[model samples]
Structures are given as C-alpha cells and as structure tokens.
Target: MPHIKVVGLGGSLKPGSASVLALKEALRGAEEAGAHIELFELHALDLPMFVPDRAPPESVQRFVDSVSTAAAMIWSSPVYHGSMSGAFKNALDWLELLSKHSPPYLTDKVIGLIATAGGVQGLQAINAMEFAVRSLRGYTHPLTAPLDRAWQLFDQSGQFSDEATLVRLRTLGKGVAEAAKKMAVLG
Candidate 1:
C-alpha cells in the first residue's frame, strides 16, 4: 500500500471557486500516482483567524493535525491582488503551533505550490508560498504551477476546458509525490 499522505490546503471562501477545482485536480493526480490525498477547502472548514495569544479552536487543531501527519502537501491559493488570499494565509498562520514540536514547523515535508488568478498574472502567489514553505523548513518541489486568467479555463461545471492546464497540474502533483516518497525513504 502507498504510505505517503499528500494533503492539499487552499481555495477561497466563495462557493465553487476555481481555486478549489485546481486543488482537486492536483490532489487527483497525487492519488493517481499512488499517494493518499485529501484537499482541505478553507471555505468549507470555516477556520477562524489565527491569534498568537489565543488557543486554537477545534477546527484549527484538526487542520494542524492533518498537516503534521502528511508526508507531502500541495498548496493552491487564489491570488488576491499580488499574493495569496487572506483565508489561506490565516490557515498557514495556524501552523505556527507546530513550532513546539521537536523538528518544528513543516520540517522535512515536501510541498507543491500552486496559485490561480482571475487576472493575467499569478506568479507572485507561488513565489510567496515558496518563501513561506522554506521559512517553515519544508522542502519544495521545483515544479510549481501558476495559472493565469484561471477563471476562463474552468467551465460552469468546474471541469477544465483545456487539457494542457490539467496536465501541468497533474505533473506538479506527481513530482511532489515522487519527491515525498524519496524523502520518506531517506528519513
């Protein structure tokens, strides 16, 4: 059986947002590549804003637990202005609790980064995520996905209208899984 667990964290608060669909596709690819996968949509989870001085609620604790057990993760965010959405950023902030662990936050985990934008540009989100992951001591897959004008690619039913986009997302997912497997074995 496949032992690696790859979790996805992203999507906007809006229903049926394209960011959710993008994460679904990437997680599907990870599943196909023999990794167990789950996508956590922040909208549905309704996580509260992270506060350094306050204890986390049950939902936030659950989110932190999920990340702690995962060997790999994919983060897909809807680019707001020039960076990741506040919802996603809040979710990430909760990860600070992991600082209490022996190895600390995200140590040794492999992450795949993705960002989707309604406008003609989205790379900034991915770049920002890369910096965050590195700061958390996690390894990142060199292959990243930054989808520009992402709203145009998905249909009303949330299906991709272009094969190329799907392929790119899938490829990134597979790469992350493969890298995770290697890391797990090495450790």
Candidate 2:
C-alpha cells in the first residue's frame, strides 16, 4: 500500500479564484485517502503560450516532471467563455514536455475533472478537459465536479459557503485516488 502521488493543476489569475479553492479542497480529500498531493496553480506557474519546437522553460519542466511522476491528477479550471481558461490550457500544453518520456503524456494516469463557472457552462470546461485527458492517454473518473455559479459558492475571503459542492469535489478526488490505487495494483 505505497502512497500514490496526486497532482492538482489549475487556477485563474485572480487572487481568490473559486477554481483554486476548489482544487485545494479536492486535494485535501486525496490527502485524507493517504495519497501525497502537489498543486500547481496556473497563475503562480505563469506558463507561456505553447509554442511547438521551443524548449520549455524551467517552470514548465518542473510542472511536467510532477505530472509525469504522478499516479493520479485532479484538474480544476475556471470556465472562461465556453471552455477552460487560457492559463489552464497553457499549463496542459506545457505537458507536451512529457511526450518524450518513457510512457509519454499521461500514460496510465487517472485524472479527475473539476470546473468552476460563473454561469451554467462549467460542464463545458469539464468536457473540454475530458477530451484533453483522452488525447493524453489518461483515464478520467466517471464522477466529475462541474460547479456552476461559482461566485455564489464562495465568500469574499474565498471560503466555500456551499457544503454540498465541497462534498462533491472531495468525492471526486477520493474516487480518483481509489481508482489510481486499483490501477497501480493491476499494473
């Protein structure tokens, strides 16, 4: 029963973004499930636009390295327009650095999707992420957290006011860790 690593990636540029708070809450569930967790906030990462054929910067390298080593991942993003934020997408694009790894991009990794939106389109971002997860050769958990009207769930201090949403997000995280553990045993 070795501890698995669960990487949480995403967040908006805003200081108290609901997506980031949700990501942290989800990672807390992973921790409770006996998995080690690492979070890569998009704003802190400051990833540049993905430009093919260019060497990734040191930050991108670190991000990719963590993702490559993780047994499971939980991705959270703020839905902008009809999809994930540019920063979130840019962070995923940086994962191209893992393309040349031993197993390549997200091979055999289990991913859980979460998205926060001001409107009811959060599921759109989750769908977009599911497509990307497939392209990366990762398995997505059946349960997803598409939090709509995200602003209403959090207070000015970024505290989650909705207990139900928190439970759902945490459940998604626990599901990912449990699935990843099963995958590890099977593999």
Candidate 3:
C-alpha cells in the first residue's frame, strides 16, 4: 500500500488570508483520507512574472517538480474581479514546463478546485481554475467548494467558523484523494 500524494496550490499574499486557510482545511481533509500532502505556499513563493520566452526561475522549477510528482491536487484561489488571482494563474502557467514530462502537464491527475471571495463571486474563480485544469489535461473533481463572504468564514487565526463550510472543504479534499488513489491503483 503506497501513499498517495495530494499537492495544494494557491493562496493569497496576505498572512492568514481566507484563501490560505481554506486551502489548509482542504489539505487536512486529504490527510484524513490517508494521503500525504504537499502545499505550495503561494505567498512564500517569490515567483517572478511569467514570460513565455524567459527561462524558469528556481522557484518555478521547484513548483513544476512538486506538481509533477503529485497523484492529485487541490487548487484554492481568491476571486478577483470575477476571476482567479493573477498569482494563482501565473503558477498554473508555470506548468507549461511540464510539457516535457512523459505524461505532460497535469495529464490524468485529479484536481479539486476551491475558491474564496468577499462576495458571492467565488464561483467565477472556480470556473476559471476548472478551465485551466482542463487545458492542462487534468481531471477536475465534480465536487468543488466555493466560499463566499470569505472574510466572515474564517477567524483571525485562520480557522473556519462555520461547521458546514468545513465539512464541504474536507469533503472536497477527501474526494480528490480517493479519486487519486483509485487512479493510482488502476494505473
């Protein structure tokens, strides 16, 4: 019985941001589902702007490496102007480097999408992420989580205050891990 690795990618630059906290909760769920986890802390990653012609920086290379090994992924983003944050999008852009791999970018990997927004616009971010994941050849989980009024959902310590939201986030994580495990076993 090998361990399945589920990587989390996305989060805001602000410390204890709602988006980050949501991502943490989702990862915790993945852990509960008997999988190992790796989180790409977006705020801590000093990634340069993505330029198609330029060489990838060390951080970008490391991100690509981490993603390449994952059996499943959880992407949590903050919605901005009806879309995902540029930082999260840029990180996904870096997955282009994975084209050289045997399976190519995100190919056949299970990805769970989550988004947080101040209002009820989180779905826009999740939709954008789904498009990106599909373009990368990853399978997006049918069960996605969107946290609206994100500011009210998490406390100052970054913990979710609502039990229902917590359950949803955890369910998304567990779903991704379970799907990934099945994929790993079948392949």
Candidate 4:
C-alpha cells in the first residue's frame, strides 16, 4: 500500500496547551499506523481572520495545501464557550481556498475529531467540528475523543496522565488512518 499523509490542525494560542499535547499523541498513533503526519499548531500558524475577497497569506496557502494533499486529518481544539476556539475556526475558514482544487474542500479525506475542555463541553466542540467536516465534504471517523476536564488529564509537564484517555485518542488517530487507507483503495 502507498504511504498516506495525515495532517493535524488545531490547538490554542497557549504554548504546550492540553489540546496541542493531545493532538501530538494522536498523530503519534497515525505515524505508528504507517502514515506520515504533519501538525499545524494555531499558535505557530498565527493565521489571520479569513477575508473572503482577499488573497490568502503564505501561511494560509501552506495550511490549505497540506490539508488538500493529506489523505486523513486529526483536528484537536480547546472548547471555548461551548464551541471551538476562534483561531481554530479561522483556520478552517482558510480551507475556502481549496474550493478551487479539483476535488474541492477535503473531498475524499477522512478526519478524526478531538476536543479538550475545562468542563464537560468538549463534546459540543466536536459536534461543531462535525458540521464543518460535512460542509467540507469529508468523512469523520466514528471514534472521537472528547476530553472533558482537560486540565486534570495532563501533568505539570503537559503530558497526559490518564492512560485510558490517551489510548482513546490514539485509537481515534489509528481509526482515521485505517479508514483513509480504505477510502483511498476504493476511490
């Protein structure tokens, strides 16, 4: 089988945030599943707000290109006010550039959704992302990781302290890569 690429996008502006750490762990699972992985931390990307009529910036172009070429993706976001962070949403907005691609926005791509929250609203963010994935014409893995009380899951060093949750996140990643491979063969 040919190698597949999995792109990971999301994370809060705070460095080493729980959401980012979770994303890394999930990407590790994808790598173990024989897929190449690329991560786009929102803080590093510093993407500007989407302007419908304006040309995309270099960072936006790079992000869109990566998403366009990837066979699968893992999105991890921190829930803010019962939804995904604004920066994460803005990054998704940049995917509008992919509308001109031959297959268009996320077509044929499989996505895994993960959301971390201080309270119990992580699932809300995941639900919100599901709508976006559908709008982009992508398939989402049935296994999703909605990490509630994210602050307690990580240690002082930002590593996941809960083994079960960690395993769930990794399973989500592996599921996405495996699904993407099946889709590739079918398509």
Candidate 5:
C-alpha cells in the first residue's frame, strides 16, 4: 500500500473549542488505519481575510503549502451565526490564490469535510462548505462528520464522552485515511 499524508485543519480559534476536539477524533481513526498525519490549528496561524486584488500574505502561503503537500485534507470548520466561522472562511480564501497562479494546488486532492457546532443546525453550513469544496475541483467525500452540541460529546481532554460518537468518529477518520491511501496508490 502507498504511504499517505493526512492534513487536519481545525477551524476553531477559541481556547479548547469542541471543533478542535472533533478533529482529534477523526485523526485518531486515520492514524489507526496507518496514515501519518499533520494538524494545523487556526490559532497558530496568522491568516488574513482574502483579498482578490493582492498577493496572499506569508501566513496564507504556509497554509496553501500545507494543503498542497497533503494527499488528502480534512477540513474542519465551525458554523457561526448560520455560516462558516470567519477563521474558517479566511482559511478557505487562501485557496483562491491558487487559481491566480500558474498551477493550482488542490486539483486532484481528496477532501473530507468535518464540522462541529453548538446545535444540530450546523448541518446546513456543512452542506454549503461541501459545495464549495466540490466547486474547487476537489474530490469531496460523501461521508461528512458533523457533531452537534460538540461540548457534550467531547470531554475536557478532547476525548469523546459517548461511546457511539467515538465509534462514528473512528469510522470517519478511517475513511479519511483510506481515501488518502487510495489516492496515493493511484498517483
């Protein structure tokens, strides 16, 4: 089997946000399935709002490089006020810069979408994000992992509290890793 690199981009910037926990859950399954992983935290990066007329900042360049180097990407974003969080949107905007350059970074990359929110309504935003990923020429996985009332599902240590949620997350993580593995072979 071909080796795979999995990138998990957590969308939340809050201190210990459940969205970040949810990302950990997904990554766990991927690691167990034999994929090496790298995770990027929104708080750790200094990405700015995307501007169409100008060059992307260095922070944005780092994000794009990370995404480009990965065989598959796990994009985790939180839904805020019925839309993707500003941080999440900013991260995505960085991708648009690729189209401006000679070659795009994510042309054939596989993508797994994940999201967590305070309520069940987060599905709406996840669906919208799914569409955006597809429009970018990415192979968006059909299995999307969305956690509602995210705080209750995960504990303080970023572990899942409920058994079923844990199992489901493991399955999603496996999917991401497996997807990457499959792409690695094809490439």
Candidate 6:
C-alpha cells in the first residue's frame, strides 16, 4: 500500500481557518495520488515551551513518533504577523528536543512546506519555516504552496475553487507523495 504521513500545522485557532482547509486539501490530493495520508493538527498537540529539563508530553511523543515513522510529511501553516504561528513553532520546539547532542530527530524525513497569508509574498514565511525543518535533518520538497489572500481562496466548504491554486496544491501533493515513496524505498 502507498503509505504517507502528512501533517498540517494550522497557524491559528480561528474557526474555519483557511490554513487548515488547505492542508486538508493537500492531504486529500496526496491520498488520491496513492498515498495514505493523515492530517496532524498542531493545535491538538499542545506543548509547554521547550525547556532543558522538561520531557516531551504524550501528545508530543505521538507527533514525533509519526514523523519518525513516516517516509514523507507535509507541513503547512499560515503566516502569523509575517512568520509561523507560535503553536506551530511550539510543535517544532518539541521536535528540537529530539535532537539533543549529535543525534537527529528528523533524520531523513522528506517534507513539503506550505504557507497561506493575506498577501502573495507569504512564501517568505514558508521559506523561513523550511529552514527550520531542514536544520533538524529533514529534506524539504522544493515545490511549495503559498496562498495569497488566502482568506478568500476557499469557500464555506473549505474547498479551494481557484484553478491555479488547485493545480499548485495538487502538484505539491503529488511531488511529496512520490518523494515519500522513494525515500521509504531507498532507505
């Protein structure tokens, strides 16, 4: 079976947030392209600020476990004030904890980054986030989905109706899906 684990980090807790919906769409497209996709909400994995002595919570472990086991992952978040949300950053904080000493937490997980913002330049935020993920030893997919004026991109059903937007999202999903499959097979 085509097994892929896709995690989407919603940058905000706002109801009907476009970030979450777009993430879901990416996951759906991945599945359609022959992947078993699971959407992980960063909001649900609440974590205390990363500290030296603090251990990971059960939920955080769950997230780390998913990353460790998945051959591929998709992390999408909306830009918050020109950067990724605190909640999303916090989740990565826990991931950082996995990298104590010379050990790596993300080892070789292939990742796809997505960002949604009110402006077309939201990919700037995605670029910043990609740097973080790469630092943890994760390989990032060059293909990205940075939605512009994302608030108006989706409808009430959380569906992206725009033609070009949908195409980009699908391309991202397919690319990640293929990468995940290859990563799993090679290793």
Best by TM-score: 4
Name the regions of candidate 4 deviating beyond 4 angstroms: none
Query: Per-residue lDDT tens digits of candidate 4, residues 1-187?
Result: 6689999998999978889999999999999898999999999999999999798889888888888889999999999999999989999988989888999999999999999999999999999999999999999899999999999998877688999988998888888998998898888
Please give me the total number of clashing residue pairs in predicted model 2: 0
- Ranked by lDDT, top first: 4, 2, 3, 1, 5, 6
- For residues 98-180, write the lDDT of model 6, one tens digit per residue: 67533477777778788889877788878888888778888898898888798677676767778788778778887888887
Best by lDDT: 4
Please give the TM-score that candidate 6 achieves against the real structure: 0.88
Cα lDDT listed for each candidate? 0.89, 0.91, 0.90, 0.92, 0.78, 0.75
Tens digit of per-residue lDDT, candidate 2, span 1-187? 7679999998899788789999999999988888999999888988889999898889888988889889999999999989998889888888888888989999999999999999999999999999999999999999999999998998667799899998988888888998999999998
Question: Judged by lDDT against the true structure, how good is candidate 4?
Answer: 0.92
Lowest lDDT sum, 10 consecutive residues, model 5, at 97-106
| C-alpha RMSD between model 1 and the true structure | 1.2
Q: Cα deviation of 103 in candidate 6 (Å)?
A: 6.7
- Which lDDT tens digits does candidate 3 get at residues 69-98? 999999999998999999888888888888
Q: Which 10 successive residues of model 6 have the least lDDT summed?
A: 1-10
In candidate 1, what are the lDDT values of residues 29-50, reduced to their tens digit? Answer: 8888899997789888899888
lDDT of 1: 0.89
Q: Estimated TM-score per prediction?
A: 0.96, 0.97, 0.96, 0.98, 0.89, 0.88
Off by over 4 Å in 5: 100-105, 156-158
Error at 148, model 5, angstroms = 1.5
Local lDDT at 65 for model 4: 87
Clashes of 6: 0
